[model samples]
Target: MFAIERLNKIKELLLAQKRVDVYELSEKFSVTEVTIRRDLDKLEQKGFLVKTYGGAVLNDKLNSLPNASSGDTEQKFVEEKRMIGKIAAQMIEDGEAVFLSAGSTCLEIARNIKGKKITVLTNDLAIGLELKDAPGVKTIVIGGDLIPLSTMLVGGFALQMLKGIYVNKAFLGVKGAQLDSGYTVSHYEEAMILQEVARISSEIIIVADYSKFNVKGFARLGDLTMAKKVITNTQLPNEYKKYYFEQAVKLFTTFDFR
Candidate 1:
């Protein structure tokens, strides 16, 4: 992997997990301890962390801010997400309403949406704000309890808002994905809401990076069967690629689009 990509992932891990060990990062990226230290040093110089005895801790200044958490999520796989977002945005036709689920990748989709006259329903505060000023886009945020650590809105209030309407397409993001587990997230309440949305939508499109592949989370919403298409990075393994194909799922890679 490129240095910038690895750096972004390390930053992401530190922000999410609070700390990062030199050895663990080395092993995770298949690099040497010396290389990991250099990476940490670079982060340190940029005020992202404080180097400890054997690892680095996320900056104290960043820990208490919700914005920091969301920013870090966007740091990883940025190019891939941007490409996926661009391609996903292109898939939407004029006057077709769509649902934009909450996540870093889904936020990218919101960012890349073009000048189409369409209504947008989303449970993400970030997505709502992103499209607030866009021309020819009408955005609606679902009513729900806000998750403390991020901007996601979920639960019964969100579900009730979707009762009478169906969207042409729903773009979703997943915390983990496996053939067995399908698409999952850490929160059960959010899972319930997303599952309902998936059921009501005519077509489901998942936007995720390779890091989510084979990972399992606490709660699942929809499976590969429910997802009509998946937009992801080229870093995904051929094994998973073949697996999606066997399931009759259309997989669009960022590298292919570029």
Candidate 2:
């Protein structure tokens, strides 16, 4: 594997498991101990992790904030997320009604949605707050019990509120996206709300970084078939590309821009 890909795997491993052993990673990636140490040093310098005795851990600053905080999650995959957000935002037209889901990736899309005359509906409080001040963009929040971690409304109330409204596009984020488990979320309440959003939208676009792929979460929201398009960073594997394509879901990656 390429050095960049190996480094990303190490990051993902640290994020998922809070800690990683250098020897284990060295064996997994088929790299020498010296090379692994060099990789760890590089990641530490980038502020993505902290070097431990025999491994590395995710930076504490990145872990301290709630997952709902766009500021925190934005630091995880800066460039790739921005590129995906830009492309997803481009798919939206001036007058379209769009639903921005609650997550870091959706927040990025909200940031770039300026100057568009569009009706925006979301269950994400952060997205509402960000777009509330933008002129000519009507923002609607689906009211329900607020979940602080994701800053999203959940429960039957939020689902009931979205019963009849159909959006041109719905941009969603996933905790995990796998071939077997499909799109999943770590929390059950959030999954319920996302399921409703998926059902009501005319087209669903899942905005996720490549790290989300191959991971399985606690709750399964829906399959790739539910989404009309999957927008992610270029690091998505060829296996995923083939799987999504065979499932008839259009997969769009940001590398196309470069």
Candidate 3:
């Protein structure tokens, strides 16, 4: 129980959980909250995490993170996305048609769609591939030209195909979210596709991780009014929880699944 040993163990926990509360860490290590704060300060100085009011969130840049509209999705918030996806995938029921919009978080949902009797439609090439061979799951890739680096198909063909379906549920991944600005994205085409999906769906769900809460994007996708539910990680800021609640947007986090 040397300080060095405790610090290293805290780092390990932060790596796994992505965030750690000072109170929980204090109890876990049989140390005072003051001691845990000092440890967090040490870790923060080492560029491991960014200290919040009561805890530390892992510093993810390409590896500590946020470009607002979009960045390399695969590289950011790996564990957080996995947990968010797990919760979202559970909402999909048997004999339902669900739309999973493009993004790494949606790809995680596609991965967990196994053992379900459902039809999934998506413009995300990665998500389509992930569910390509899933048993009892029918996957339809919206046809169009692929967008560079993003691996998404969007445009006239994608829209034309979207016109024919009545989706029971639609899950979209956004670049950022803010109470004033709503969910936003970097590209107009992405916004168009998302809007069309939302229009044709019975229920709309926005899937994002904790980092997207305060961040703003270039294009607004509409206010929280459009999204009936938003799925994110437990690490989401409290201000956002209040915002979503006020907007009457149901928020589901990783804690629900755990």
Candidate 4:
């Protein structure tokens, strides 16, 4: 495997298992013990993991991505995500068809969607569970391989289902947002599904918090040109504002709670 691919697998293992042994990782990735040690050192420097005598442990820092099962990061930025969700909810009109992407922010947007005579398509199991029984709102859950960490379905089945239908608007979530990279996710499969969703939506709205700005992830979703508008918190840097304007991407900010 390539160096980047190996690094990503190491990250996935660390995130999923919370700890990884150097010898075990060497055998799993088919690399030498020295190479595994080097990988651990690099990951530790990136703040993704902490080195131990025989292995590495996942980091608990707020700036680092939390372990998949921890769910702490989602709860940490709850209010900021809710504010972004409220603004995104306003964009939906009654009786319109909408697609909601998976993420903490988009999950809040699904909850904030009020009395709307609309059909909602989503791969997020959480969003489906929240809006499934709501009166007058039609909810369709896309079926495919389940990503346990994100609790979303993405793969051949989901992509095929999306091909048969289109939406008036789509609300997306990102692991990072850069002027050059557009939006990104931590995994390749998720990025592929997101790109397909963006292609079939009439208007693509990205719901991300200010912390996402300038962050880099493992995979690229698309560039800024793909989004019609980006809804985020007011703390977004002025440099990003200038870049988005130049790229013809409209910027929408929610009220500052801080």
Candidate 5:
């Protein structure tokens, strides 16, 4: 395999097992021990792992560990999330009716919708609060059982609120995006509500950071074709870029820090 592909495989192994033996990796990749050691040394310098006596361990201190909860997940991808939100927000035209799903990135989208006359239907309590002070924007909060840490509402009550209302666009945030099983969120209830949102919207725009790619969550939302566009940062892998492009799904990337 090529060096970049080998490096990615090593990362995937470290993510799944938390540690990797040099001998095992060398055998698995069919390369010499010297070459595997060199790869580990480079990954160590990039803060992806730590070299040990005979192997390497995933760098927990560098965010290589899995997140414990949605709250932790939201806080970990701050920069990419904010940029994704900014790009998604710019797609909105004045007076459009939009559905903003519940997540940190969706909250950022709500925060960035400045000086626009729009109607926002959202289950996220935090997003409602953020839009309360913005002029010419009508914020509708879908009511149900509140998921406190995520500041969102879900379940039958929220589903009832969405009935019969069609939207111009739906901006959704998901826990993961997969090539086969498709977009998913951590909670089944949230996934159900998101499905309803997708049903009523004429257009779907998924707002997610690059970290979410190739990951699968507990509940499947929809297939990849459900979304017309995806807003994310430039860190998306070339493989995914080619896949999305081939699928005719438009991708918008924001690489800017500001």
Candidate 6:
């Protein structure tokens, strides 16, 4: 294929996948890695993509990709998150303090709870705002540097605040969950605060949809073993059931819970 045709194909892939690595592109196009890098450079210069360490991501100006914790992300896995959220909220006992991590799934958990007198500590600005009218639920925000994309407060300030309190459970979210890296998120600062939240909580429960499986992120929060339980949709593949059992992590699926 011609150079122009290959470059156009790469752009199409980026639009669909949001990100792509040089190695994969090279193999897919039957070209050298150096050739792929040159194509990426051209794309970046044209303001179509932003080149990362070994990959390229869609440029914000060119693609209106939704924020990670925004409504769009919420809608992507609506039914799955709703099921996981309800099951996760059920894990909380009445009047128990809990840490609700920032994400679409975590927000669903917050929305599903009713008539529960609980103290909710969260770094998500949206979660804190939603709990204001939750009747019987007291919401506290962990103040720090706010990340606009995810609406999460990270950095040292948030970490210190979380350390001062212990909760019954922490319902955490992640960009991906892989057998090797466990739970992972996109940003390093976010991962740091999430790690601390998991540390202080007695039970670390990961609430994710089936889509998150096998996807790896830029930063890993902790190993899968850190989770006491995992709440997911009924669609969780059967192949992963044995892994969760071996890790001694309890799995709650909508199939059984819902």
Collision count for each candidate, in order = 0, 0, 4, 0, 0, 0
Q: Per-residue lDDT tens digits of candidate 6, residues 143-228?
A: 99986434789998888887668998898998778888788886789899988887788888988888778767667888888887
Question: Comparing 3 and 5 by lDDT, which wins?
Answer: 5
Candidate 5 segments whose C-alpha is farther than 4 A from its true place = 1-76, 256-258
Best by TM-score: 1
Report the backbone clash tally of model 4: 0
Q: lDDT for every model?
A: 0.84, 0.81, 0.81, 0.79, 0.83, 0.81
- Badly placed stretches (over 4 Å) of model 2 are 1-76
User: Candidate 5 on 1-258: residue-level lDDT in tens?
Assistant: 899989887876565335677776775677999999999999999988889877887787744345622243344456667888888888999989999998778988998995899999999888999999998898899999986334779999999999989999999998778788898886789999999999999999999888778777768899877897999878888887998999999999886645
TM per model? 0.75, 0.72, 0.70, 0.72, 0.70, 0.73
How high is the lDDT of residue 86 in model 2? 90
Tell me each candidate's RMSD, in Å, in order.
7.0, 7.8, 11.5, 8.0, 9.8, 6.2
Per-residue error for 211 in candidate 6, Å, reads 0.9
CA shift of 89, model 6, Å:
1.3
TM-score of 1: 0.75
Model 5 lDDT at residue 61 = 77
- In model 5, which residue pairs have backbone atoms overlapping below 3 Å? none
Candidate 4: worst-modelled 10 consecutive residues by lDDT: 62-71
Candidate 2 differs from the real structure by a C-alpha RMSD in angstroms, to one decimal, of 7.8
The candidate with the higher TM-score, 2 or 3, is: 2
Please give the distance, in angstroms, between residue 149's alpha carbon in candidate 5 and its true position after superposition: 3.3
Report the lDDT tens digits of candidate 3 across residue range 1-258: 999989877776566346677876775678999999999999899888889877887777523334321224333467678888888889999999999998778888988887899999999888888887888999999999786535789898899999867999999998678777888875688899999999999999989888767666656898867887999988888888887788788988888665
Per-residue CA lDDT of model 2 for 1-258, tens digit only, reads 999989877776666445666776775677898999999999899887888777777788876746622344435566688788899989999999999988768888988887899999988898999998999899999999986434778888888899878999999998778887788875699898888887888889999889778776667898878887999977898899888888888888887765
